[model samples]
Target: MNTDESNNKGNIICGRCAYDANPRGATHCQKCGTPLVIASVPNSDPSPASDSTLLVGGISVVATVLFFAIGGYFFWQQVRVASTPSNLNNSADNISSDIRLYNSMKEVPKVPEGTFNYGGAVVFAPLRNSLHKAINQVYPKFGLRFTEPKYNNPGQNTGITMLLDGELSFAQSSKPLEDTHYSKAKERGFSLQQVAIGIDGFLLFTHPDVSIPGLAVEQVKDIFKGKITNWNQVGGPDLAITAFAFNPKFGSSLNILLGPELDQLSPKVQFMRDYTDGVRKVSSIRGALGIGSTGAILGQKSIRPLAIAHGNSKSYVPPFTDDGKQVNATALRDGTYPLTRRLFIVIRRDGTIDEAAGVAYTNLLLSQEGQQYIEKAGFVPIRN
Candidate 1:
C-alpha cells in the first residue's frame, strides 16, 4: 500500500544507522535509539534522485533567508515612516496657514452657497447619493446646492488627503478618525469630528455554485485562507475551493470579519489583486468562496448570501434590521448570522468645511427619512 494510504505510517531516516522504518507512534525508533518525529511528505518507493528537487530545495532555503533580509529592509523603512510625522498630521507648518487664518465670521454659521465639493468612499454612494438628491430638492429653499461628489473607494487614506488639499469644500469617509489624520488638522489648528450616519451588515458571501445554506464561523475562515480549498472541507459540493479577497489597497471588510482565523494562519495565505477580481474569479470558478461588505454586494443577484452561525457573542447576529428602530435586531440579538462590522465617517481635528460637509451629510443620513432611503438602497439599517 502507498505510505499515505496507511493512516499512521511514518518514516524516520537516521544518518547514524541508515535506519529507515515506519517509526510512527513510538517514543523511540524500534530499530535504533533515536527519537521519532513526523517528517515532511516523502518519496514512498525507491526512486532515482531528483536533481530538480535538490536544486530547488537548496535555492528555496537560500531564498527564504534572503527574503527575510529584504523584509527587514522594508521593516526599517516602515519604522522610519512611522516615526516621521506625516504631512497630514503633526506637521502644522505643512498645511496652508490660510487654514488657521480663515476666521469664522458668522456667529451662527450659514451653509455655504454654490457647489460644495465632496469626496467619499464608494460604499456610501447609495445613501449619500440619495441624501444629496433630496438635499437639493428641499435645501434649495435655504439657498444650498451641492455638486455631485467626486470619490474614491472605501478606506483609501491617500485619496482622501489629495481631495482635501484642493478646492474640495468637504469630504466623506467610511472609516473612523485616525491619529495621523487628526494630527494634520490639529497642526492646522482645525477642530474635527465625524458622525455615525448609519450602520451596515457585512454578508458572508459564496459563489452561487456553492449550495450550502451557511457556514460555522471557523469554517468560513478556513475556506478563504486556502486551508479548506475543497467544497467538502465546508460540507458542500465536490469542488476545489479557492478563497478570494481584494488586495488591501482596497479595504477588505472580509479581513475584519475573518479576524483571528486569518491572523493565526499568517504564513498560509495567498492573495489576489482586487475585490472586483475576487468576485470575478469566484463566480467563474466552481465552488470558490468570496466575501464583500453588504453595501458592496447587496442587490447583486448573481452572488449568494450565507447566513453565519455564530455562538452567542454581544447579542450579535447576521442580517440585522434593514430598518433602524429595533432595540435588538434579528441578526445581532440572535446568534444566527455571521458577518458584521460598523462603518464610520472620519474627520480631522481641523473641522474644515470638508468635515462640515461630512457631518451635514451624516445628519441627513441618520434622520428618520434617511433610514427609509437606506432600505430602498438595499442596506440593513443599524437601528431597525
Candidate 2:
C-alpha cells in the first residue's frame, strides 16, 4: 500500500458490517451502505416562567384547599342537624322550653289558639264533664278553649253529622262510624278515625219510687213492643207500662244494645229529645221506664237501675255487683253485661288531629292519670 492510502485507512469501523476502517469524513458505512448517527451530550437549560404563570399556580393550590374545607364544613353541619333530637317528643328530662309538662314527660299536644266545639252521645256528657276538668289541670297552656258541650237533642248520629258538616271539631260516639257514614266521609275526601276512651253500659232504669226490682230481657222487649201493655204482666203494679227512649233518628244506643228486640219495639213508642229528657220523663211518670247510660243514671239520685236477665239464663244480675256501689267493669268488658257499649273520640283521618283540641283531649283520656277521670265519670276505663 502507498503512504497516502495507508493514512486514509484510519481506525474508524463500520458499525453495521463490522468491516475494516473507512476513510475520514464518511457519512455511512462504505461496505454495507448503511446510514450512520453520532451521539452528542443533552442540553440542561429549563424554560423560564412568567409572572402570570406563577400567580395562576398559587391560586389553583389555594382554591383546591378551600374547596375541600368548605365541603367538609357542610358535611359536618348536616350531621349535627341530623344528630339533634326532635324537640316535639323528647323525654321529660330533655324537654325543650317550647314544650310544656303534662301528666308525665310526654309533651302535651299543642292545639291552635281557638275555641273548639264538640258534640256527641248525650250519655257521654259525664265523661266530657270529667275530661273538661282533667285536661285543664294537666295542660293549661294548650291554648284550646271548649264551649259547653251540646247534647243537640239526639245521640251519636247527630254528633257525627255535625262533625262531618264542619260544625263540630270532634264528636264523642257511643258506637263506631257506620258504613254509610264512612262512605259519606269518603265522598267528601276524608276519613274518620276513632280513639276508644272508655266503656259504658245501657241501664234499664226507672224512678226511685217504683217498687219493681228488674225485668227480664224478654219482658223489656215485650214492653217496648207494646206486647205487654201493663206492668202487672211483669209482676209489677196494675199501672200501664210507659216506655220512653230516644227517637229512631237520634242514633240511640238502645237500638244497638237491644239488637233484634229493638226491631220488635213499637214505632209509636214515646221518644225523648235527649237522655236527660228521658230521665226527666221517667222521674215524673209513675210507671215510666227509660234507658240511658249507667254512668248517667248513677249520677241521678232519682233513678234506679233494674236487674236484667242474661239471654235464656234463669239468673238475673244487677247493673253493679258490689251492692250497686261500683259499676261492673269486668262484666261489661267480658260481654256478660247485656247493654255494654264503647265510647270513642273521633278525628279526621287527614292528620287534622295535629292542630285540633281533640288530640289533646284524647291523649289526656288515654294517659295513666286520665283513666281516673273515666271512673269519676261513672264509665269503665278502656285502659287501667
Q: Best lDDT goes to which candidate?
A: 2
Full-model lDDT for every candidate: 0.47, 0.61
Q: Pick by TM-score: which candidate is best?
A: 2
Shift of residue 213 alpha carbon in model 2, Å:
3.4
Error at 289, model 2, angstroms = 0.2
Candidate 2 regions exceeding 4 Å error are: 1-107, 141-152, 260-263, 321-323, 353-355
Q: Backbone clashes in each candidate structure, one number apiece? A: 20, 0
Q: What is the lDDT of candidate 1?
A: 0.47
- lDDT, candidate 2, 1-384, per-residue tens: 001111223323544445334343333333332222221112312445211111111233245346546675754443343224332112211111221223531445564545677777777777665577656565555433332335556578888898777667777788866657755665665555566667888888876666776777777777778888887887778887788887656766667756766677786578887767888898898888887777877756676778777764536667776667788787777777776777877765434643256656665665657777788778887654
